[model samples]
Target: MDFEAMAEYLPLYKDAALLTLGIGWAGIAGAVVIGLAVALIVHFRIPVARQICRAYVELFRNTPLLIQLFFFYFGLPRFGFSISPEFCGAFGLALHGGAYMAESFRSGFESVDRIQRETSLALGLTPMQAVRYVILPQAVTLAFPSLVANVIFLLKETSVFSAISLMDLMFVTKDLMGLYYRTTECLVMLVLFYLVILVPVSLAGSAIERRLRYGSFGN
Candidate 1:
């Protein structure tokens, strides 16, 4: 399997891995914040804001992520803004994946009891206050599993960034394979590399779900 030849490509693999994580983590952090904010707006029926959020979700969700990436990377330059491919790629993920994440979070908000909303009204809490105090906390627990799943999905999506010369994992791997002709080894290790990140994330999500179930403030 040309194991010795593949081992010589360690530096290339390391660079790819670091770049992948940097972009993936940054994009995910943004997506989480934006997704939750949009989800809350829709879940609580926030007048014009709700409709705007719905429109955003539909627009992004209905579109292919690659097209979004291409638009940001290829098309935006026409507007006289010089953005790095990394920035375009990350922004695309934050915008596109944020839509799906919003839906996941919205489902969590749906699981909240109607009485909770009524009780907040009875207690003179503003709609914002109810969402801030009561709904978000529960929604986070419900949404945590799907959130973790999305993280893995987004991490893999960074592979697409390679198309824009982002030099992420898949890009470097492809280069290494082409240079050394160690396709099988490189591809197999790439699969393992992805799993190395994703498997722990899966385990952590499961652990959090169990804790949420058994610990204080049960859903």
Candidate 2:
């Protein structure tokens, strides 16, 4: 715990931390979009669409994220599908993280009651209408907690992008640690950086859940 060692690394530490947050934020945003789309496909139980969605979820969820990152970063180039490291990293993160997210949302949908659905159908709603108006609203409420956890996980998982040279916070931190020899100081800050993003996300999720619950009670 050499304070001076950390002081020596302060500037580099700041740079690396910023990079990590930037990369993580971008990757998480992409994951949220892809994940929600995948989740919806599964939730609706579309014929071929559901199967394809299931296949994607199974394929990505079962494998190591690092392997997927390598596949996107290295293997794709062999097929003339070249992309930047950041692009590859983000693609891999979204695809992989989205798999789990699909499951979380699907489970939430499954948790929805049969009566709510029946009531919606009785109200002259089509299947899509029932889902969009009746089922999905409650499902999202149930899924909110799990989704928030997954978002935090996905954000933390963004660190893996550094392996492919994404220059995210973790990548920057590593470089800073090497340069300034303040491993403790920089890492502590890095942890704080992660919490900075994750904590607010968690709070936002809670707020949304509260609103949903309020709506549910017709209050």
Candidate 3:
């Protein structure tokens, strides 16, 4: 194992790790927006919109994320639209993550009591206001653990961006290995870097779950 070679490349790997996290965070934010919208549509039984959301969730969830990224980065350019690799990667991650997130949000929405919505309506709140003020808050708390899990999964999946030359942590690691012929050292470093990021995130998720379960956040 060429530990010295790995040490020499540490700074570059650190930068790449940050880039990976940035992409993952952006994707997760986008996923939350998309997921909330889809979940709301289904929750309200919004006729055609609900069906469209269901189709979207099914399509993205059933397909491999790599193919989805390729379609955005490679296939779309074949037509007229051309987006940068970074944008394509982040957008692909968002769309794919959104599908799974939609399911989680849907389950969360279902867990909220129907009476809350009725109470909101009785208080003369508009449907939108009721959803915003009453139902979504509870739903979010219920779904948070699953949402955290999904975010972490998406973070790990960002490794796929390496195939499209995104220069993420995995990409940098691969480059380092190729340049120095230190596969074992590079792979070990890669695992350690990912663990450093993901372990804390998993721990934080658990803490959040506990707090929510115990009403520590005041429900």
Candidate 4:
């Protein structure tokens, strides 16, 4: 292992890691918004909109993120819709992650006891009020763990951003390996950088899940 080569490449990898995190988190934020909106529509069984959201969830969940990125970055140009690589990366992640997030939230919403909704309505609360005051709180709590897992999954998926020509951590690592033939050093840095990003998130998620579980038990 060439320690000098690894050290020399550190700055580039740092920048790329930041870029990856920025785009990944931005995509995750977008996914949360899209997922929440879709889940609400599905929960309410909002006529045509519910069907449309269902179709969207199935379409995105079944397809590969790379294909989605390619469509956004390359295929769109044929139709004169040229977007930046950054936009493609973030947008594709959002669309892909949104599908899974929607499912997670929808399942959480449905898991709430039907009796609670009925009771809220019997107490003269409007449908939206019932959701806001009764259903949403418990559903969000139920969904928090799944949301954390999805965020981590989406962050890892950012490695595919290289396919769209983004200079993410994976891209920089591969570029350095090819240029300097420092495969061991580059791979080591890649693993280290990823662990640096993911380990804390995993640990934090576990901690939060434990707390939520305990809270649920009224301890």
Candidate 5:
């Protein structure tokens, strides 16, 4: 283990970690948007949109993310739709995460009683107003745990972005190991870095889940 080399590379790792977080968050944000949109479409049974959403979910969920990344990063260029590796990485993560998120959200939406929608309609609310005011809030609360789990899983999966030259934490660690030939130190540091980020996220998710489940919100 090259302690000196590891020390020198610490700053690089820090930057890479930050970059990874940014990419992961971007992906999560996109996923939320995609998930909600698809869930709503599926819920309303929108004619063409529901089928498109189902096809999208199946396509992403069934395929390996690596292949998706490869298609985005490599295959699209053949058709003149060029994108940067970073964009490809983030976009792929979003697309993959969105598929699973859609399922979570759909389940959550379905868990809400259909009577609620009927009640809202009886009270003279437009369908959009009813969904926005009554349906989505309950659905989101119901799906919170699954949503958090998906986000955590997506965060860890950012390591795979290194394959596309995105220079995330895992990529930086691999580079350091290759440079210094300090496999043990690099591996240990990689684990520690991931633990540093993921542990708090897991704890926080649990805490939130408990609060949501209990309907306390610490009040």
Candidate 6:
């Protein structure tokens, strides 16, 4: 509860917070891309590709991020594949988040009427053009809520990145507490920093959701 003492660690927390955001956003962006790709493949039912994408979704969605991080950071070296801890953290989050995102997007894709594809084709749109102009936009609008939730989920998952020695907020908090025995101060800062990071996302998601609900953007 010592304000002066807590102020001393502001720089440390700021840096850690930045790192957390960098990794979290990077991972989330990658997840969205990977998820869309997987969803598209499965939605189109591309024989071999669909099975592979389905297996990927099942595997990553069913596993824990910590174990995945451990495998990437610790286990891979056994096979001579050495990745930096930062890459491992970001990549693991992407792979894990992608699985859940795939389901969310796939559900959205399915919710759209199949006749839209046929109609677009009858209008002389190529298959790829139909997906781009008709299918994807509607699917994204339908899946917007789930996509926002998944982004938030992935951001929180960044907490586990510390397990791999990345200087994320949780790592800095734990390290400071261990060194100074100021557990209360460290924990308060941890909560505050996380709120700082997550609250905006929640607000932004709500704002976007409202816009999509009432705005002509979806039309």
Instruction: Write candidate 6's Cα lDDT for 41-106 as tens digits.
Output: 999899999999999999999999999999999999999999998899889999999999999999
CA lDDT scores, all candidates in order: 0.83, 0.79, 0.90, 0.92, 0.90, 0.94
Best of the two (2, 4) by TM-score: 4
Clashes of each: 0, 3, 0, 0, 0, 0
How far is 22's C-alpha from truth in model 3 (Å)? 1.1
Question: lDDT per residue, candidate 4, 1-219, as tens digits?
Answer: 889878899999999999999999999999998999999999999999999999999999999899899988999999999999998898999999999999999989998999999999999999999999999988988998889999999999999999989999999988988888888899999999999999999988878777777854323
Of the two candidates 2 and 5, the one with more favorable TM-score, higher being better, is 5
Q: Against the true structure, what is each candidate's TM-score?
A: 0.92, 0.85, 0.94, 0.95, 0.95, 0.97
Off by over 4 Å in 6: 216-219
Q: What local lDDT does model 6 show for residue 49?
A: 93
**At residue 26, what lDDT does model 1 achieve?**
83
Instruction: Identify the candidate with maximal lDDT.
Output: 6
Model 3 lDDT on a 0 to 1 scale: 0.90
Candidate 3 per-residue C-alpha lDDT over 1-219 given as tens digits, one digit per residue, 9 for 90 to 100:
767877888898899989898888889899999999999999999999999999999999999899999888889888989998889888999999999899999999999999999999999999999999999989989999889989899999999999888999889888877887788888898999999889999988888888878957443
Per-residue lDDT tens digits for candidate 2, residues 46-86, read: 78988898898899999988899998889999999999886
Model 5 TM-score? 0.95
Once fitted onto the true fold, the runs of candidate 4 whose alpha carbons sit more than 4 angstroms away are 216-219
Candidate 3 Cα deviation (angstroms), residue 183: 1.2
Q: Ten consecutive residues with minimal summed lDDT in candidate 2?
A: 210-219
Cand. 6 Cα-lDDT? 0.94
